[model samples]
Target: MENQEQKKRDTNKIYFLIAVIVALLGTNMYLYFQKNKSDQRIVTVSDEKTALQTELEKLETELDQANNSTTELSTELKTKDDELKAKIAQLKTALNKGTLTAGELAKAKEDVKQLRYFVGKYTADIDDLMKKNAALTGERDSLKTTVSNVKQLADNLSKVNDSLYTKVKAGAALKTSQIQIGAFKIRNSGKETDVTRASTAQKIKVMFTVANNPIAEKGSHDIYMRVLDPAGNLIIGEGGSFTANDQDLQYTYKTAIEFNGDAKTFTLDWTNRNNFEIGTYSVILYADGYTMGRGSFSLR
Candidate 1:
């Protein structure tokens, strides 16, 4: 009976010990499973956080891209451009927060939406400004063209007035007729007599009759004479020059005449410095840029 009892006690003790070991193993498994569950929960939260960070970064990059065009706004819109840049900076700050809840992220997304809308409206405003600027430029160009045309018209009218004045002045000039030149022989006593022989000539006489013109100016006019030798060379006296109708001519002699619009005869003389040539010599008279008379004389 004692042995049986002892065997029973030993079996009971082994069973109890096995039950305790089994209970301990159960507790360990429960704790391990709890730890694993907690770890998995943490990993899931981290993934959500990573996704939020990625989304925030993407939204920030998009906002930056959208705001980059603000620099293109004109000076008049600089205030609006600055405001938009500030809004973009605010969005970036919100996205960069260390701990962002779902509600906060949702609010940030809402803000991003508002920013996108703002950017769209700003773009529209910029478009409107550009259109207005183009219209103003066109108007300015049209005004310039109109001003240039007006100036050209005024210049043309001025040119026409000048031409009419020139024509009127030319028409009012005095005329002359019956021009004659005579070669003369000079006596030792300074008396000149008409002669045509080269050996006997010592003086030249020029005579003309002024024609009556009702419009001629009543003034004293200086007449210039050109004497050309047979070789078409000028027989210049004292050096003198005058410009006539954009042409300059050298004169050999000059005389002053008074014009009162009445036809009158006049005579002038040139003393010979050398003996007369054997060919024909020419004489032309000019006054006030007008050819008063022309004549030629021959000597042998």
Candidate 2:
């Protein structure tokens, strides 16, 4: 009986040892599976992070490209705006002058249309540019109107000749005795006649014969005489007669003589208040405010 009991106890001990070994192996297997699962989760998270970083880099590149394109487009638009403004100015100048033909007007209108289209197409925030363009358009239109009015005035003046009614006849050839420095044709008529120097009281005589010129109209034309000293200074005072061809019209000078289709001699006497200088004096004759003829005489 004692031997059987001892064998039973040894069998129980062997069974217990086998069970402990199996439990330790199972624990090790479970720990290995858990560590593998943690490592796989870490690898998946790393792969997801790499994909997100690549997507962000692509987005940034696209944004940079978009900004560059915007800048280039803005620059191009500004250049186009400047070109359009210059074209508009030229067009306005041509249009208002009335000198532009039909074809040119049509072309300018088309250009203006094109400019308007371009301005309308601007997508950027260009309020200042739009305002400037509007101002330029207004200025161009104003200048066009002004030039058009000037052209009309010039055209009207081209149709009529107003200078014909103011015409006058030519005068006669002047004579030497008419410009004599002393009394009329008499030796020592007043004093010794000195062409070089004369007292302020001496009288100078002038004579001229009118010539039959077709330019001399039959109207009663006024005559003007301008006397000049040697230095070309006017000897006449400023308060001379201001009458011309017709008594109705008052000009710088006047003389009423009927032109009877013949030449006539006229004599004029100038009494001097200032001493005559030793030089040539010039006399200019005018009819109806038109210079008819000129004559000169030496005093010295």
Output the number of the lDDT-best candidate. Answer: 1
Over all chains combined, what TM-score does candidate 1 have?
A: 0.66
> Per-prediction count of colliding residue pairs?
0, 9
Q: Show the lowest summed lDDT stretch of 10 residues, model 1.
A: 62-71
- lDDT (Cα atoms) of all candidates against the true structure: 0.79, 0.56
True-vs-predicted CA distance for residue 240, candidate 1, Å: 2.8
Model 1, 189-210: lDDT tens per residue?
8777888788888889898988
In candidate 1, which residue pairs clash?
none
